[model samples]
Target: MTEDTLRSVNPATGELLAEWPIDDEASVTATVERARVVASFWRELGFDGRKQALLRWASYLVRNTDELTELIHKENGKPAEDAYLELMLVLEHIDWAAKNAKRALAPKRVSPGPFMANHEAVVEHPPLGVVGVIGPWNYPIYTPTGSVAYALAAGNTVVFKPSEYTTSIGVWYARSFALANPQLPGGILTAVTGFGATGAALVTSGVDKIAFTGSTPTGKRIMAAAAETLTPVLLECGGKDAAIVAHDADVSAAADAIAWAAMANSGQTCVGTERVYVDETVYDRFLAELKSKLDNLKPGSGADASYGPMTMPKQIDLVREHIADALERGGRALVGGLESVGDRFIGPVVLIDTPEDSRAVTEETFGPTLTVRKVKSVDEAVELTNASEFGLASTVFSKSHGMEIGRRLRVGATSINAPLSFGAISALPFGGTGASGIGRIHGEEGLREFTRTHSFARQRFAIPGMALLSFGRKASTVAVIRRVIGLKHGRHS
Candidate 1:
């Protein structure tokens, strides 16, 4: 491929799927500037019009499911079923955003304080002119769509930059909107392709808001760069999510869920289970069940494979490094070990009794690996789980105290009795804190992420005696206001 073009290759077999000319700063800037003009047309469409356009795009995606799924598989190195599931999530967010954006961003009336009773106060959420979205290679369709769909529904035009690894998938996702809604203008949704440079250009392209999903280090860099222009950003970054199995947990169910969660999509999921903290009372039972679930699974590029090859080839080294570090630090592998980490496909690797300070335990593996630690009690499990720097999302398994345990975790979203359940629900907002990342995507929080809040206060009628806001206010008004404040607020004193 030429230096100015991107080569979309399959990680499993080194097959070249497609090639496209990449975007640089000049092209990305032009796209964003054009989107700024189109933003006016899209915003003027209002909620109802925007909803129709969004729903139509959803319909197109649904109708072309096979095509989209195949592209996702080819470009993302995910199995067909997993790619379909990812596309399913994209549709869910699109449908939800199309239907709920109005209510989420609708104007609302607020009660004026006693002193300003003559004025009517209202709060309105208007779309920021345009949004720039930078997506990740993992979960290519679903992750970025969380922002693209909601931003479009919220009446903002979007300029999306799919990861260089999955440029084809990103381009297809953006092109779908225009194909589905030819009745609308073209610049409402568009994509720019390339490596990090293209994404960097979008951040400084003067878009109203920037929505990004990627690694923590990259997310921080984007935030810092965007800060130069004082641009607002919605970042969905890294996660080393933990799954806690309490003494009262359903051992078999927890094992079954965690196995699938920790290995799905080659464990590249941002919210996947990377760490497991199990109460000692149930540790043996849970380990046995988990081993059975992970034993037969294998990675391949076929329809019947458990998952598929690692999408990013470089990620395999990190996975191996983490496993080697754990093994060298006195940890024993209960399942596959460093030997199972292939050049492109990594089998399931489960480490037990690893040092808490080990990189595998403290950092994000982003592979089909899990670190299991036995804790003295549920409280100890929570403590160890919360010790990690990443706090994106987590899972809790307990028959009786699941909710209680989940509430105590420092993560953004937690699933009880299930792994990664919060992600499937469209209404729940998804995000993280601390090193995990900033802002949110999905739900009302996501729709508002691309908007600006405006409060309007109109004078309905003037109280003749109280000219408080006028230049001709009487001294009696000040005296009356002081008396009212004393009567209302001083009574408790």
Candidate 2:
């Protein structure tokens, strides 16, 4: 990246994909102002109007899926199938948000207390005006659209700053929305491209809210910057995610799912499995099955590639550092080792007996690697899995106790007897409890996250002599109320 321009390159072959003039603070401010100008128009669109526009955008993307997927494959270096699947997830979310927005954010009546029986109360979810979304590159379309779709469905305009690595895809995303709805105002959805300065500019650009999906440290920095304006933020950050393979589990099925979960997208997923705790009774069998499944997988830019290269070239060094750290700390690798870390792609590296505190076991590796450990029982597995500072997502496998085990896990989303099922379900809210993230995306919780709770109280009628809200309160009314209150409270004990 030069000082004046940002470049996007394919990690698979170092092929230059696209370039753009960087969006600096001044330009970002202008973009935000444009979005802010249309804020009221978007909010006033109401549920039905906005839903139509959002659905059109979804349909447009569906029609142009081939173009977007090819771009994703070229820009982010994921296999074409994976790129298509990511687009499919984005469409599902957009459809869900459009169809469910009314139900999730509409005004609802609330019962007034006994003392205010003559009054009626109601609660409503109002859009937070313009929302600034800083997206990630791993699942650029699926992840950021999680924020963009929901925020727009809830009536908030969005100024999205996609990752520098996937800037063109981000541009395509915003442009697609505009193309889908040419009748709508321009600022309802827009894109600003650049690196850190561009994103930081958006954070401080006075947007009503910022929905960021990125690294934990970057999330902390964005949160701190947003704090200066007391701007509300929804942070979906890093994860050192773990999975448990139980003694009673189907070893074959668990192995297949965990292999994909750990290595897909070159393991750039925030909720992807990085660590595994296998029941000691089936540790050997599980390890063998897992290794067998991964043996058939390969990383390339080809259609048959198990996955593709790491989207960010710099992240390769970090993966190497983790591998070196684990090997030096007495861990043994069953698959690839330090030598597997290549210029573009790192093959699947599976480590066993890595110390619990080793960087490979504790940190967010963000690469195609796995750390497997054996635990005495499911109880021990749960304990070990929850020990990570990142409580983002996890998978549990047990024939009869999958749900039971999942409930005991500390992560925000848990997949029982499956891998990444939580992510596939549009109705499920996804987020973490600790260093993983701040708030949720996807589902009703996600819809409401971009809105503010507004309460309203209306007086139906005023009692002839009871003017409690007015300055004309009477001693007689107070006496009667005290007697009734005492009687009502005295019955509880």
The candidate that achieves the highest lDDT relative to the unseen native structure: 2
lDDT of 2: 0.92
| Predicted candidate 1 versus true structure: per-residue lDDT over 436-490, tens digit per residue | 9899899999888888999999989878889876899989889988998999999
lDDT of 2 at 309: 95
The C-alpha stretches of model 1 lying farther than 4 A from their native spots are none
lDDT of each: 0.91, 0.92
TM-score of each: 0.99, 0.98
Q: In candidate 2, which residue ranges exceed 4 Å CA deviation?
A: none
Report the CA-based lDDT of candidate 1 relative to the real structure: 0.91
Q: What TM-score, to 2 decimals, does candidate 1 have?
A: 0.99
**Clash count, predicted structure 2:** 0
Residues 1-493, model 2: lDDT tens digits: 6787988888789888888889989999999999999999988989999999999998999899899999999999999999999988998999999999999888999999898899999999999999999999999899998899999999999999999999999999999999999998899999999989999999999899999999999999999999999999999989988899988999999999999999999999998999999999999999999999988788998878999999998899999999999999999999999988989988999999899999998899999999999999988888888888899999988899999999998889999888899898999999998898888899999999999999999999888878876688988988988899999887874
